[model samples]
Target: MTAMMDREAFEAALRQIGAERYHHLHPFQQMLQNGQLSREQVQAWALNRYYYQSQIPVKDSHILARLQTTELRREWRQRIIDHDGQEASEGQPAQRGGIEKWIALTDGVGLDRAYVESGAGILPGTRFAVDAYVHFVQEKTLLEAIASSLTELFSPNVIGTRVRGMLEHYDFISRETLAYFDKRPVQAKRDSDFALEYCLENARRPEEQEAVLNALRFKCHVLWAQLDALCFAYVAPGLTPADAWQPGTAEKENPRS
Candidate 1:
């Protein structure tokens, strides 16, 4: 049987996971901040990352569906609204949601929405890692699923750094283009706070605590690997996957072609 754990120690373990594995350490992110990538590489990144952006609310909704309390559901539902928008009134086009805003980012970077949404340009590692996250949430214990979200514990600072660095270094990217991030720090805070509390409260055994911490570590790896693949394929001379998106080429217009 798994040993029981104290809450404080478990919390410490989760923080340690963040300290070691978060994508803030990724060389690609560093190069990006340092102005090393070409315009095309940056465009490819924004295009591929649209898949991750689109997946966020789906993951949140799956996690939200498992929470039993009305109050908890209330807390979690805001995440959906943040990504999907409130809905259309009778007259106006449906208010633009986070996904739409993300499309704006891709458009700003010169990627076609069809190509980005098709996910043709995304790294294989990105697809695998993101799929792992969704599967983890659906298959793991609720406490562990919540724990996986604790990556946001470390996200605000990184997001701040990214926004400032991208704005200062990249001439092609503008504040309006990066608006998707503007509300993320705040949203990440609210969501992570709730998830952290859930994990700390429910992870009552040493083994259980460790499991949750490891879940967070797994999620960190998921984020880190995406950047690693991007660096290898886009920044370095080679390593692009066979099926990966090649910038500057349009998708074939004919269905059979």
Candidate 2:
């Protein structure tokens, strides 16, 4: 059995995994933040990324159902609300949610709302990656499921970089279009702090500790694989997979050049 590292050591080691393997390191991301991708490539990114964002609540809901404590569920349910928004009354305006914000981003990029919502146009890799995350939460042990969310620890930095880069470079991307990200840094910090503390407290055995680490590593793979598919199909070889979204296929006509 692996000797258990001290709590500080364990936390530092997990942070190292994010530092080394997170998708922010991927070439696709570099091109994205560096302002090197074409409008079409940027369109592909926004369209595909929506699939991931939309699944977040589904995955969180799965984990939420399995939590045993009222306090835990209270904490977890906010994540679902953050993405899905609160229940609205008839004739009242809806509370803006992350999913709606993501739709705004796709629209700003000239994608048809119907096409993006239907998700028929996204890459195969996107569906597979997002679906796998939902399944992992449903199937894994409670501790492991919570540990997977540790990806949130690294997200603020990535979100900061993405928002800044896109605003500076893409004419179509703006503070308004990227409003989905504006609140996420605070949300992510709160979520990751809770998740990390949960893992450190619950994972008493060395093997369980390893499971927590591996869970975070698997999440990093899920994120990195999505980008790998995007880079392969959209950026380099320039071959979008069969049945995936093609530029200008939006239900509404794209007004951009």
Candidate 3:
């Protein structure tokens, strides 16, 4: 924007970016949420997505390492804990992180956890998109990095839609299987509130505001690109990309795993 917007206007602009460009609007997401995809296709989505889920803490850690204040680090460290899990204490069992919960979802869908965790079957496009997101956080200004995380603002609604739709349509999907989403809405709100407030406070110049807006847009592209790759390779054209997972192949690696 040529003129810097007021804080409310800036937040509105960010939400507009999510409305117009978020992956929830993508065809592959529609197919997965609405149960238009087969079980094998769902397996593929879960397995490939495990890479993204696993890397969340890695991205957050990069951001945490760069924060200059203990208060900011304290505020941000919960994100890492939420994804990576806190270790067990004297009386408590170890809590599985989101990555582990995602593995449960994969297992619920009949995939091998070791194979999924190996990143052995992930698509090229998926890897590229997730790596770009991590690098965006690592290389960008702290303000821009925080801005990119504002995608969390729109996630609660999409997660609700996905959880409900998957439960209603897929017999194999149980509440327990989709448990990874159970706490996400609340966690996302906490994270996005902190991120949005950070952006509003830090982005003071007109050019800075524009950069923040563009950072969010870039984050949206990271999401949209993953679905685009998935649809072309597995959903419509149905041609698995070279070296990517194929559901029915008899190779010893077993892409379906």
TM-score of each model, in listed order: 0.90, 0.95, 0.95
Backbone clashes (count) for model 3? 0
Candidate lDDT (C-alpha), each: 0.82, 0.90, 0.88
In candidate 1, how many Å is residue 248 off?
A: 2.2
Candidate 3, residues 1-257: lDDT per residue as tens digits? 49989989988888899999988999889988998998778888888889999989999999999999999999999998888876799999888788878988887887876778888788899999999999999999999998989999999999999999999989978898899999999999999999999999999999999999999999999889988888878887887887887885312254234
lDDT of 1: 0.82
Q: Cα deviation in Å at residue 140, candidate 3?
A: 1.1
Model 1: per-residue Cα lDDT over 130-170, one tens digit each: 88898898999988888888999999989888889989999
Better of 1 and 2 by lDDT: 2
Backbone clashes in model 2? 0
lDDT of 2 by residue, 125-219 (tens): 98999899999999989999999999999999899898899889988777888899989999999999999999999999899989999999999
At residue 164, candidate 1 shows an lDDT of 91
- lDDT for predicted candidate 3 compared with the true structure: 0.88
Error of 3 at 158 (Å): 1.1
